[model samples]
Target: MIVPVILSGGSGSRLWPVSREHYPKQFLNLHKDDASLLQEAARRLDSLDNVAAPTVVCNETHRFMVAEQLHQVGVEHARIILEPCGRNTAPALALAALAACQASASARLLVMPADHVIKDEAAFARAVMQGQALVERGRLVTFGITPYTAHTGYGYIKRGEALGEDGFNVDAFVEKPDAERARAYLENGDYLWNSGIFLLDAKGYLEALAEYAPDILEACDSAYKAREEDADFVRVDDERFARCRSESIDYAVMEHTRSAAVVPVDPGWSDIGAWDALYELKAADDTTSGNALHGDVMLHATRNSLIHSESRLVAAVGVEDLVIVETDDAVLVADRRCAQGTKHIVNELKASGRRECQSHQQVYRPWGHYRTMVLTDSFQVKEIVVKPGAQLSLQMHHHRAEHWVVVEGTAEVTQGEGHGNTGDMKSFLLSEDQSTYIPLGTVHRLKNPGVIPLRLIEVQTGTYLGEDDIVRYSDDYGRG
Candidate 1:
């Protein structure tokens, strides 16, 4: 049986502001549909036959989001493995393969990144089916995208001999070439864009790793052996996994393996590495001058650009070849030609310790989300939304006091007398327009009991208003 391994470790810094470190592009609705890229990737498995539950490898900080998105898509019993720190594709796949082998000895992994886009599900299904026999026979299979253009952005794969009917033996794995070389490869008709999607026998790949990169294999084996299960999360040993060298699967295994094979297909794939990539999604149909937009956006004579407005109306006039992205707290304006250079901007922001690079103004938690409304040294105000039947941790702040004003639905406030410890819990119901206050160092818990969502305005006054000021004594989402 085939088990999809969804690698979702990328920060997607080129798509920053819209895609932050805390909430990356994989979870965002880049396709302008209700489902995110990760959800779509999971849902795409519905097209494949005899596929078992997928294994998702992601950052530890993004565990809740990954679980929530998969749950939204009804992908239950899926393994969500948490990487304490990114050791790149090689280690990520090793953990996933080990888990798959433990579950079923005859498992084959269909490894794909969570952030990839495929327009034709049928084409993808056909491509995967084409490599089934090859993978079953212990051949490491990779899906090579049919190159339609001389694009210098991606690496190329050269095919050698025909492997059965669906694939060819991988002649060589080449790096991203310059414009002249990319054109040469594109015109050669024997090359394909090296799409990172792969298919391999779980045990077979592990054996190949043990031979090729034994240090990565042993480090991952030690970590996976010491891995612990916590609810939906599989926690790998951090220190051991950290010692594993960071490298891509291409550099670590595929390039060195003699059994590497490629299946060429076109499913309208794009990694969505930058804003221009999103714009190009529709430019082919509109004579290379279409404006791809999301949210509330208006354009007058804007050509070959992308305008994404998250919270407000963004109106652009007479703009050509530009990328305009607007969110609640930040806006990005860039030339479409140089949109990939946003990585440099993100690096600068990280060096300067900017919150915009890490998270959005609206932050997601296990319960729901909170948007920072107003913040200062002495006081901070936030708009908090709790999902129905969800609640905050029963905890207290050491340096801050909070006042919650209910704006929608209902809240059950559990107030404690003193610090964050066992005490007489005084409970009260707060309806719309009702207000409550909890004194400094007082333990408090907020729960949504209504059928609808609970929305409230939280005003806090304190010496330290940072998120770390609160100590979580008890949390339903298992923070404790």
Candidate 2:
């Protein structure tokens, strides 16, 4: 059996504004569809023979988003593994191999990153079949994309002696080459772009890892053995998982292993690492210009430019080779040639302590979302939406008082000292034009009793209206 391990733990900083630290590009519908990149990745393996439900390894912070996205795609029971901290691809794969080995002793693991895009599913499946055959013969396999150009953004893999019809022994792994060397590599038809997809048997991988990356293997072994299974997630022990030395699979094992092999894949695969790459994938006019995600854009006489606006209409006049991104709090305009340096801007924001670099004005929660509409010294206003049957934590704020005016649907409001009691909990069914007030230190909880989304405008008056002022007494979603 082949157990597909999907790694979805990247903070896509290059595509900022649209992709923030809390919410990255993998979760967004970059192709302007309901399905995200991660969802598409999970769906791609559905037709493969002997494929088990995907085992997802993601960061702990993105656990809710991962769960919600998978649930949206009708995946009810996938093995969702949570990484306490990222130790790069090697340890992540080691943990996944350990899990698959525990479930089935002879399982073959097909590891793929969740953020990639493969346009041709049939070609990808055929490549996977070749990879599976190689893995069954005890070969550590990696997919190498047939390079289309002298692109310096990605590393290249050199092919060695041919092992089969569609497989070759990996000659060497080369780092990102300079422009001249990249051009030379493209000219010589023996190199392929390192696509970072791999296939190997569970026990074979563990043995190869023990030989090449013993420290990583040992750390992962201890972490997996010490893991505690929650309701639906497998939580690796924090101390052991953190002790794993951070490294990629290329550096730790694939490069050093004698059994390494490569399979050529030319299925329109793209990592989508930068704005320029996204522009290349998008539909373009004669001017080679496109709009970024979630923007009202109008371009005239523009060529090779990407304009994105979130809050207002953005018009570009006579601009060429530019990237313009606008969010609620910040806007960025840069040359398309230097789009890779956008990470420097994120680093500067981190050094100077700016919230705009981290998240947006609207924050997503498992229940719903709350957007900060207005803020002031003595008061703050927010628009909150609660999904049907969803409830906020039973909590109280020490330094703030709140007034809620329901605009749509019905809200079940509980107030006063007897917050959780059966008889003392007075349920006030609030509808349109109805409102309620809760004084400071009063234990209150809000719930959407109706089948529709509950929308409300919240006005707060307090000495301190920060989010940390709340003391959660009880929560339904296991949040402390």
lDDT of each: 0.91, 0.87
Residue range 287-354, candidate 2, lDDT tens digits: 33454434688878777777778789888889888888887878888898788788889888889998
Best by TM-score: 1
Model 1 over residues 1-480: C-alpha lDDT tens digits?
A: 999999999998999889999999999999748899999999999999999999999999999999999999899998999999998999999999999999899899999999989999999999999888788666899999999988878899999999879899999999989989999999999999988999999999999999899999999999999998987899999999999999899999999999899999999899898888888885665664587878898777878888889999999999988889999988999999899899999999999998989989999999999999999999999999999999999888889889999999999999987766458889999999999998888888999998899999999999999998777778987786
Q: Name the best candidate (by lDDT).
A: 1
Q: Supply candidate 1's per-residue lDDT for 46.
A: 95
Under the 3 Å rule for N, CA and C atoms, how many clashes does model 1 have?
0
Q: Give TM-scores for every candidate, taking all chains together and pairing residue i with residue i.
A: 0.97, 0.95
Off by over 4 Å in 1: 284-289
